[model samples]
Target: MYNRLTLATLASLPKTITRPRYAREALRPGILHIGVGNFHRAHQAVYLNDLFNAGKSHDWALIGAGIRPADRAMRQALEAQDWLTTVVELEPGANTAQVIGSMMGFVPVGEDARAIVNALDDPNLRIVSLTVTEGGYCIDPATGSFNPEHSDIVYDASHLDAPRGVFGALVAALRRRREWGLAPFTVMSCDNIPHNGSVTRDAVAGLAALVDPELAAFVHGSVAFPNSMVDRITPITTDRERTMLTERFGIEDKRPVFCEPFRQWVIEDNFPTGRPALEDVGVTFTPHVAAFELMKLRILNGGHAAIAYPAGLLGIHFVHDAIANPLVRGFLDKLETEEIIPQVPPVPGVDLHDYYRLIASRFANPDVGDTIPRLAQDGSNRQPKFILPVTRDRLESGADVTGLALETALWCRYCAGTTDEGEPFRLDDPNAARLTPAALAAKDDPAVFLNLRDTFGDLADAPQFCSRFGIALKSLWREGTRATLQRYLNDGF
Candidate 1:
């Protein structure tokens, strides 16, 4: 009983969650990870942990950093636990918990942003990785280019000495590294954006070009931005997750991460200076990461958007609950197999059917408890990346786009700021102010809504799409979400 009590006490503390058995002592910094969120914890950090556990590359432990104030809480939690995180993998019948110890330390964004830049400029730091969300890069969503004109970016561009944003911090740090004659760290992007490495390269290089052409040329020539395809459904942590960790696993990790059992990370093998031997731990270093990226983005993320708006309108709360609804599930499957898959170019050696099955299983993981609101948030940004790209592909190929058209209309109706019960709906997007107003105003004239050059751009003005989307939106407004979905399903569109 005494031994049991001691074990319980140790398990409850975050610091004692996972004690590395034979892992080597920390080595010099080789990687600087930005936006250390749950996905990074589950995906990249897991790979790094496996490498350390195998005694391969202990020198490359992670140094985590974040740009926003919310990241302060994460930094403090991890620092309290010595940068250890309890990763729980939820399987159908069993669950497993492993404490990941890849992160060595964290640097919070200070008022003047000196600390973050100093960390980045550290000669020991070799690879600078980012899981910063798509929006975090300050890319103009419609154009898929860096928005140098963005107020925050503009401010940072002018005030480079006192950098404010992540891009600014990166440029300042690179400048210091140049001054110190240290080789620039490879910038690897693990975000979900299509061609993420190139996107990040463009964002960084684009910003640098506006400030200093020579610096931009240096980055373009020396630094390697490797594209990657990452997949894992890591739900936001909640009180329930914390309690489960303590009660079920007897681990009290302050910043415990819960994720599905399935995980995938495919990276382009293009680190110029040096990188961790992550390939030793199931990280597929591929030349065809672009194909894999397109497959995941269109299939997984696209499926999420296809189901999210309709599920929200139907009052479904959790992802599993939404999937359990036969109507919603059937609609999603049809969209993938019939409409979406037809346009997706063949990804080498990937069985689309098997991929679809895997997606279904992942979405059905009740342990994840991913919320509809979380998926529904920022539809204005998500739809273009997840839904519209496929829609455009189908339309361009002259394929049937009725299902895709319905998906877009459902999204527009969802943004109208009210539910079927007439309760005020919440618009959870950065572009909410612009998108919501356009959506409301387009209630009578959809062309006006489509004209918001920011969200839809030219895609909104396509004649056939506009007509179909207009019809679907009008039907949804008159008949309600359920009836409109039922009509689309029964009518076999």
Candidate 2:
């Protein structure tokens, strides 16, 4: 019989399972991390757990905090187990489970940022990290810049004390710290956005600029926002995973995370106060992390976007299944090899083509069980960050974007709320209200979808892109996803 996973039962877990070798009682909170989602638990928390296991950085334990309502559910679940998480690494041959003890505590969840802001005000907290998804940075999707005019930014700026979003809470906390003569905490972003640290700095300092220009200046000058590239194919937790944990390891973890065996972290070494010795555990810390970050955003994340829509429209459930299909796999292979890789600049110590091969192999891991739906969600946010930049780069360099255009057309078609087989599925984007109507309209008038200025930006106005996008979208509606993919593969647009 399985026992409930808690600090009480942690020592009794199966001998085959690996867990923290250190004492949780010895851990001290030095970092307050926002958005404690599956990826954070799998990637950042895992690295810290390794660091602590090596008998170092005990004071840098993570204090998980979040501003979203979903975080409340996460807090409740983890609180039931004394803030512990069971992470299962799935390999083709065998899987393993571990109870990560990196997170020492979780902040109470609420709409207003009071609780999170209060957590940030702690003097012991030297670094305030975030995994608040790509869209959470208050960025203008079209411009790829900080949007001070965002409603959340406006709310947080005026209501500094009872801020409504992450940036507001950060502003409030930093302003208070500056007044108290305390140094501003380092703001490290683990999101997938290009130049994530700079983007985060823009959001936080930009919000501060609205309330107090002096505070904005202080935030800009004092805080360190280090760029980092984090990789792990962590799928959402389900009952299947819970059962596997119970059956295989005799542990009934409420929120067990299942991910692939591969994990990578390349961080820019810019922390002013201090950081854990993650390097000892295999994290690459360098003076320049831009090349690594760009390579990942373009190759790995961009590959996910490339395959997501076609798989979703074909009713392929699992990511590996999509990759296993000859047509889908062919589409991804051709697109990355031709259009995507050429646009990527050379990294310091990496070969772009080899990196693409590794990404494809990872995507094809059946044990990972990553769903097409998870990847296909939030295109409005993802497309801008992943696909469009490459498109813009190709267009600037006077190269044809046939594969890029097809990828975008596939996205537009996916937003139409049905598969090729007439199966209706919910459009999962936050902009569904806008996207659905536009997608439906695009079936008749392809330009209608491109008019989403916030998403397509001036790319909609580019005659070449518009022409290819129009032809690709019409072809999909006329010939269907598979045929359209096959046609693109056989002949160039």
Candidate 3:
């Protein structure tokens, strides 16, 4: 048996497993991160750990907060171990483990969110970061605007004093800061959405607008939402990972995170009330984070979207196994090289082709336990963000979107709730009820699936894209995924 991970047990950890070098007690809270998930731990928290180990940014430690019922479970898990995380790095040759100690505490998870709002009210908490996923922003896909009419937003508007959601809590805190004559903290977005900073501003300011236009103006004018691109293939931790932590690393941590060896963060330098010197530890602070953001969103994220449905439809479980399939890998290669990469503008000092190669290699890492279902989940939000933007660019440029159309068709086939092998799986999208029936109906007329104006928007009305999508969907229904992918590989169409 292994000792439970805590500050005391840090000294007991094996020499191979790295633990925090700095004094945990000396670390102070400067960031109130809303989400405490694996990606945040593996990416942002890891960066802070590095900065702290270098004996800097002691006051810039993180205080985790959340707005959902699920956050309570995470809090319980992490708090049990004294807010320690055993992050396992899965690589091709060897695996490594580290215990990160940057998070000082978590706000109590509750419906009223008074704890989180109160935490945000502190002036010392200068940066408010988020990894709440792309869908959590309460944005309408069709209009590309914040949906203030959303029930959560509507509820938060009336209950600003005891807001239930993240934005509501932020508005409450900002309102308090304004009245108290304190400077507003920066709102940083680490999620994978294009122009994420601007999107976050709209969500927070839009919600504030509902309460009072003046409050909205104050928030819009004062708060700085910095756009950022964060990359780390962190898979959901299952019992297998927990078992690995015990067997391989000799750490009995309840909330261990398993991720690929590669991690990156590119941030826009816009923090008004001071921030961590993340640039000292490999973080790229830039004025134009958009180019980097777009390149990653299209190539890395879009590539995940491209491979996920095909792997899911083939009944593949792990991401490595899916990419290991020659046909599946070939489909992604062709799609990115011909259609996807062509649409992405040049990112400074980075070759687009080289970046795609790196993405492919990362996906092919077998040890990370990244699941196809993880990538496959949230397609209703993902497709519009990852896949359709490329489709839109290609269509507008009068370029052939044959590979993208095939990718879309694969998503539809996967949504029909069955694999090519006739095994049924529940669609994991939030809009599953609407997507499933539409996908089922599309077997007769492909336009039925395209009519999800919320998803496809006016792209359904384009003849070029529509015809290609219809033909590909029909082919998937008849020839199956394998044959269809082979045909696309053979014919550049």
Candidate 4:
């Protein structure tokens, strides 16, 4: 008989799925992960579990923490099953599943984050890793800087005793770390931003500076925020996945994450308080992580944003189908080759073209079940980091930004509250309320959207980009998404 997934029921799991061989009771908490999402469970947690399974890094067990109301539900689900997650690796034909036990437990998710701050204050917690998505950084979409004016940032700044956000938790904990004469933990960002480590450092330091200038100095000088490039095509869990686990795997897992079998992690080696032997796993630690970060951001992440708007407007639901569409796929290949890759510097050992090939193949894997909405979500945060940088580089180098500008225009059109098929769908973005009005206004006048100095910067005033963006926006409104995509596909704007 199938049993619900738990440490107590590990031996009862079906033979196909791999369960942890090591004892969970022996694992000591060493890392504090902020977000317990699919990507974190699939990527970071998987790597640590691999290290633990090899009978190494037993002390580096992850203590999961969250700073949101949604995290409370996640905590409830996981706590019922001993914080174990069933990760199903979806390959083309052969499938593999595993029960990950790297997380010891979830910290309380509430307004008062003293529990979280106390956990971070612990000397044993040498590393504070985050997978809180690109938007979770609380970045101002227009300026690409941390938004100190954000409500959460404002609240956390004023209330030092009981901070609510992750940055606040870190700041409060660091205040104690400095006061108690303890070394600050390494803060590693596993998010998908360009120069993610440096971006994280800016956010943390900027927040700390507002809270206390002296504490800010100590945090700025003491903490090591490592930049990292993390990749895995992990999709959100759904009722479909839960059903699959029950029918095929004979395990009643409350939370099961399904993703592509392929995974990669490239990290900058900057851990100050000491780190686990993750290099023994597949993680590549390098002094120069910028090259890898830029390559992945501009190529893989940029390509995702490139296809998402068009695919969503065209009424395509899944990512594999979107890339399989000749128009969408062609647009991605051309945009990356002609516009994006040229702006990227070469990594020491990796071929750019081979990387593109790998990314395209991964997108084409139907089993991954990555959705267009998942990719298309949070375009405000995504476009600036992933697409706009490449566009800016091309513009400065005097290269044509027709394809890139068109991509941005497609984004504007996508934000206009309806798809090309005249069907309405919810645009899940933090800035959607303001964005929709601006986008709708942009349909008549492209300058309306471009005028947002925070988002477009001086790109709107640049004659070439301004003219091309106007043309593309007009064309998308007059002709349609498909025609515009096909026009770019044929190398014409």
Query: lDDT per prediction?
Result: 0.81, 0.92, 0.92, 0.89
Query: 258-301, model 3: which lDDT tens digit per residue?
Result: 99999999998898889999999999999879999999999999
State the TM-score for model 1: 0.94
RMSD of 4: 1.2
The lDDT of model 2 is 0.92
Candidate 2 lDDT by residue in tens digits, 55-100: 9999999999987779999999999999999999998879988889
User: Cα RMSD (Å) per model?
Assistant: 2.7, 0.9, 0.9, 1.2
Query: Which residue pairs come into collision in candidate 3?
Result: none
In candidate 2, which residue ranges exceed 4 Å CA deviation? none
Error of 2 at 217 (Å): 0.7
Could you tell me how far off, in angstroms, the CA of residue 403 lies in candidate 1 after the best superposition? Answer: 1.2
Error of 1 at 216 (Å): 0.8
lDDT-based ranking: 3, 2, 4, 1
List TM-scores for all candidates, in order.
0.94, 0.99, 0.99, 0.98
Where is model 4 more than 4 Å wrong at Cα? none
Q: Residues 322-428, candidate 4, lDDT per residue (tens digit)?
A: 99899898889998898988888989999999999999999999888899999989888888889888888888889999889989998889888788879999998
Mind giving the per-residue lDDT tens digits that candidate 1 earns over 33-82?
88988899988888888888787787888899877776788898787766
